[model samples]
Target: MVDWIIFLPACFALNMACGPSNLLAMTHGAKCGVPFAQKAAIARLIVFVPMIAASALGLGLLLTASPFVFGIAKAIGAAYLIWLGIALWRSAKTLKSEEFLDKSVSMKIAFRTEALLAISNPKAILTFAAFFPQFVILDAYWQSYAMLGAAFLIMEAIAIFAYALGGSVASTFAADKIPVFQRISGAMMCVFGTLLLMAS
Candidate 1:
């Protein structure tokens, strides 16, 4: 269990840290609410943990062995992120700027959007590929990493929930409430996409 003690904090801190994922959650929660954030959180976790586990189990090795495949994935992910950014920016333009959030985004769209946000993040792939191995018990196979993965996901959900709650509170006092969330989300996606392209 020492691995759990050592790794869980690192995982929590890593997840809670400033990143595009948290940025999206905070900004989005501010615009929507707790339910929106929760949906996004759960959807993101469903996609996020599996991908990390895949990498931890064997996909990371595959990527290492096949640079060409990784390159292709990197390119596709980068492009998708930018595409989402453009879509978000366009949506922002469609909606009227209002001080109060008069519009409600459905859970399905929110879930899908958040899932895409989590999946498109190449940094998560790279992070797990690098960090997850450090704590693995060689003989334990999947069990060690599985424990870590569960802890990471739980911590991640809590961190996002906290961020969302804080963001919602901050939103009320925001001077430029209108367009704040959309603009931030759109901008972050574009920035993340560019970063991913650069890293690729």
Candidate 2:
């Protein structure tokens, strides 16, 4: 029941801030030069699914609860979104130096980094809980919830993939222009943060 298209951008933005994905991409950009696609896919696989499941469960519980609890959850979720937006905005301006980029980072390191990032991201958890049930009709069968869940998973998968690919391609062309890339990526993060605040 949720507008899958509308939810895609929010999901993408939330995932973009994911520490592992961003760190891996930044590390690769700085050192071994792995394609963004590879990094993104790994990030998505390791991080997204578990978060999505956790979110679905949390959201489902909230939706099934009383109106008061639901309202409290919404408020908490909104405030968290605002905080996340600010944090991301600040991160936009801080670029890792080439020296930092030159360090060797293993896939295992990348996976652990992403896992921690995903686990600690309260915004991601609340967003999934708050936004997912909007499409579910209470009177409808349980199948409605299942459908929405599947739709969200698919949308998030595609959006994260595209973002990673784009980042990889853009990073390649901007390889000679690291400063520019950093600035642009930073600005984009700020913009995403702003959007999240506005949406909340």
Candidate 3:
């Protein structure tokens, strides 16, 4: 059986790879004077949990059917990351006041965006497939799988919360210099994307 302890670090790494957008989103909400903690918590519970569950199950089945499919998915994900990285990096150059507008974004929109982002990430899907079954004993499907999935979800929630809190703290420092900070954060996101693509 796979050691449960190892899954925590794996989940953390996966979150670190895909967490920039979530951090940025929460920071944007915070800038608009929205309560980021509550919104972030809600986003995880209402959106991330279900998405992770469905994606895990679906990807698990897909990998069982054809392992090669994951390679293609990883390539696609890498390409998408590169594209996103470039866009974020470019936005860093053209920082504008309107970009940080306090416009109200609905919970539904936040939930949907997060869900789509998490689902489309090949790293996330691959992680679920590769790591989840490690804990599952040959015949003890229910116990092991449930524990693994639950551990992933809990780790994800904690990591997201940490990211949001970090964003909030960063925002406080950049309150008066929003544009500059946006550019810096955007550049950081680009770096993250580049790393993800290279790793893939």
Candidate 4:
């Protein structure tokens, strides 16, 4: 049996972490709107489900054992994040001249960005592999893991909503200063990329 008391809080904490993906959610929410961001954020869960399944099936451990593979994954992720940061920074200039956000941001673009960001982050898989096992029961391994995965997805959805709401609220207040918000988000993304690169 899974320990709901402990696992719920811990899992929620992990979901609520101010990670790249969550930051991206906030950025999207500010740029587009909460409803648009929430819809796009579903792509994260789509990617995570297979990742969690893979972790449960033990491929996460195999990948972890291979430093070469892990390094490649981390490098790709860091590079993508840095590139995204730079792109956003450059785009901030264009946003400043306009009173409204570029409504040109389509659902497809947002969906793809969310999906790629989630997929590129190797830590997502590692998180599932490392964190889920602690709460899983050996005797009912599959059942317990399934339950944990469901719980994680639920908590993740809530976290996504919370972050999106926060961004939405901020954007509402800073309606006249959207460009400044974009610049800050862009800088944070760059910092996150650099930190990910430096991580052991």
Candidate 5:
């Protein structure tokens, strides 16, 4: 049996952690719209389903033991983040308040970006492997694992909504400073990418 009493709060904390993925949600929300951002966020959740399953199947342990694989994964993720940041930074120059939500970034691009980011983060697999086992019942392993995965996805959705809403609100609050918001978001993403690269 899963321990809901202990699991729920921990799940919520991980879901709401200030991370690059959540930042991407906020950035998308601010740049496009809440609805668009929410839709884009779905891509990550879709990818995470397989990730959680892989963790349950012990791929997470493989990643933990394989520093080469982990390094490669982080490098790819970091490069993409840096490129995305640079693109956003450049786009900010031409972003108009009236057409902010109608800018160059397409739905397809957003979905791909979200999916790639989720897939390339090996740490996510480690997180699931390390965290989920505590609540999982060995007698009902698959069932409990599936339940925890479901709970995680639910919390992730909630966190996505919250971050996207925050970005939308911030966009509204700084309606006149859209360019500034873009620049800040871009810079933050770059910093995140750099930090990811630096992480050992």
Candidate 6:
């Protein structure tokens, strides 16, 4: 069995390999700038707390037991992703300048956006259900799970911040191409949403 020291870094690397959420984070980071974008990422993680807890507490099994229930959740998540992608596509040309930063993206908006992307991810929930057991020793399950969750959060946070830094840099240099960046990001999100649906 792999120790946490070995497992967590592997998990972190997997997270950083680029996925829908990571793409969204990178795009949002460019849109909102760094530390603020990192907050949005963390906020999204906060929103997932309930699901994480549920997975650890056996609700994951319960939910999985009912195909109908899981299907509904999966559908809702797919819909939300598609909807969010459309919204991003529609707002591809949102004006951004120095003064605009003041009214740029309210924390509320950022939190909601990130939360939607985070929470609606069925893959995340399923991954938790499947993967957590590998690291868990039921003899000391609760404690082990707690440690695992902490590692997930820590690694995820670090990855988000790193992606945000990359975004901030791109935004700084190609500030004039904000609209182009938004369009590309929006298109990618839409593709991701479609991919999710197809995965079902």
Please tell me which predicted candidate would have the highest lDDT against the true structure.
4
Model 4: per-residue Cα lDDT over 127-200, one tens digit each: 89889999999999999999999999999999999898888888788877877777877788898888988888
Task: Put down candidate 6 lDDT per residue, 32-64, tens digits, no spaces.
Answer: 777788877887779667777889988887777
lDDT for each residue of candidate 1 in 51-169, tens digit (9 for 90 to 100): 87788768866875687877777787788788877777777765654533653766787788778878766667776787888887878858878876777788888989988887777
Q: Give me candidate 1's TM-score against the actual structure.
A: 0.86
Task: Supply candidate 3's per-residue lDDT for 88.
Answer: 50
Q: What are the TM-scores, per candidate, against the unseen true structure? A: 0.86, 0.52, 0.68, 0.96, 0.93, 0.89
* Window of ten residues with lowest summed lDDT in model 2: 23-32
Worst 10 residues of 6 by lDDT: 94-103
Worst 10 residues of 3 by lDDT: 29-38
Please give, for residues 1-200, the per-residue lDDT of candidate 3 as tens digits: 65757767866676555455555555554444335544544554455455446544565557536747756655565565556556655764765545554445455655654554555556555566666666666577656666677776676666666666665566566655666666665666566556655663
lDDT of every model, 2 decimals? 0.75, 0.51, 0.58, 0.87, 0.86, 0.76
Off by over 4 Å in 2: 1-36, 39-46, 59-104, 139-142, 179-200
**Candidate achieving the largest TM-score:** 4
Clashes of 6: 0
RMSD (Cα, Å) of model 3: 4.1
Candidate 5 wrongly placed segments (more than 4 Å): 103-105
lDDT of 2 by residue, 1-200 (tens): 55567665765565555533353355344334545335534664556566656655565355435566545544544454344435434543554545324544566655554554444444555655676667566776356556665655565555555555555555556555554555544454445444543442
Q: Which ten residues in a row have the lowest lDDT in candidate 4?
A: 95-104
Candidate 3 lDDT at 200 equals: 30
